[model samples]
Target: MMPAKYYLFTDGSVNPQSKVGFGAFLLISDLAISLPEAKKLVETVSFENTSSSKLELQTLLWVLAKLDAVATEVIVYTDSQNIIGLPGRRIRFEKNNYISKNGKQIANAQLYQEFYKLTDRIQCSFVKIKGHKRSLDKDGIDRFFTLVDRASRNALRNS
Candidate 1:
């Protein structure tokens, strides 16, 4: 019998500039090994004029819900450094009024709340990757995020 395949998903986002932005990745081990490589989950997102941390948290919530629906274990990764720094960073949303204490919370609190609710459903880990330190594949993550950010901007303009 073959082991389950794990999933490693990476995601990122951009703010409206001069504001906070976030980027993160997820890893799901103990999955059906016959599934596929872990990289297929990699993706990036973009939100205008939003906090990076919020964006990062939003991405986390999205992935977690998806994972729960599929019943998978995951370990998320991110280059945000700050978000992955402390534990339950997003959980602290209640303290900062759904945003970090230092910045404005995202406009869509309900979305974050819906996703945050899933924290209890699965086991997950948040890891920090040093930026510009050549310590955690920062370049690759940055490039992926940048591409997504630009694409998002273009999409908004077109719409």
Candidate 2:
């Protein structure tokens, strides 16, 4: 039998000092009638060499890992289009297969590989939502993209 579907909203924030924080809210499809009904999750980390894109990718990987252990089918909502588009693009795959002239691995290759592995273990899809936006759902619940965004930033600040 197929497992139930879940929805996850994720966001990541990075400061100028390379401190990174990620936030995600998960809800079983049946309970996702409002933003307040979702559960909040957050974490913080730091990278010596970091970019917002890297933080975003890490955030996706982190949330997916958590979801994989619980749900068989998950639809992830994120603001980072790059994460959503990675699997559909060929350039990154090709780069990961070949080493650069300087003999270094392609940036984010490991994360992409981990993402692929996790995706294989569970049925998952990604949706791109606009960052820092406030909108109302059909059920009149305020969409929590802005909430997740603030949560991530708060995680960074508190860390």
Candidate 3:
């Protein structure tokens, strides 16, 4: 028998200093994925990195790791379009430098590269949302993301 269909709500935030964080609230109702399974999948991914942007991307990738080979549909919501846009375009990271087709060096190559890899897995679509919105759903997501964001920033600052 088929497992089940699941909808994933994900959000990420990053400070200018390159600190990044990602949070995912999986909706595991009868129409969504199983919470226990999803949580287990998320636990398998590590968040040790130099930047929060990478953390955010890692969170999304973590979601992919949880899916059990069942054809589950995932919808990811994020506030960081700059990072999410990496895979949508023709971009590459070489020698820790983000290089364009013209060999122009882009900033945050590591984050982009990780996001690039995260974007390669599973059936997922990213939607950019306005951060700190007053809506309840958006606000709750913001709270979690803020924690991840601050944690990332503090870690980077201390390092």
User: Which residue pairs show backbone clashes in model 3?
Assistant: 6-33, 19-52, 20-52, 20-53
**Residue-level error in angstroms, candidate 2, position 144:** 2.3
lDDT of 1 by residue, 59-128 (tens): 6675666667664455555655544644455556667777655687756666656655674566556545
Off by over 4 Å in 2: 1-3, 39-49, 90-103, 134-142
TM-score each candidate: 0.51, 0.74, 0.51
* Candidate 2 per-residue lDDT over residues 46-96, each given as its tens digit: 444557778787777776776777778887777888788877854657654
Error of 2 at 4 (Å): 2.4
Q: Cα deviation in Å at residue 124, candidate 1?
A: 0.8
Number of the predicted model whose TM-score against the real structure is largest: 2
Lowest summed lDDT window (length 10), candidate 1? 30-39
Local error of candidate 1 at residue 63 (angstroms): 1.7
Ranking by TM-score: 2, 3, 1
lDDT (CA) for every model shown? Answer: 0.51, 0.65, 0.50
Model 2 is weakest, by summed lDDT over 10 consecutive residues, at: 133-142
Per-candidate RMSD, Å: 6.8, 3.7, 6.4
Model 1 Cα shift for residue 52 (angstroms): 1.2
The better candidate by lDDT, 1 or 2, is: 2
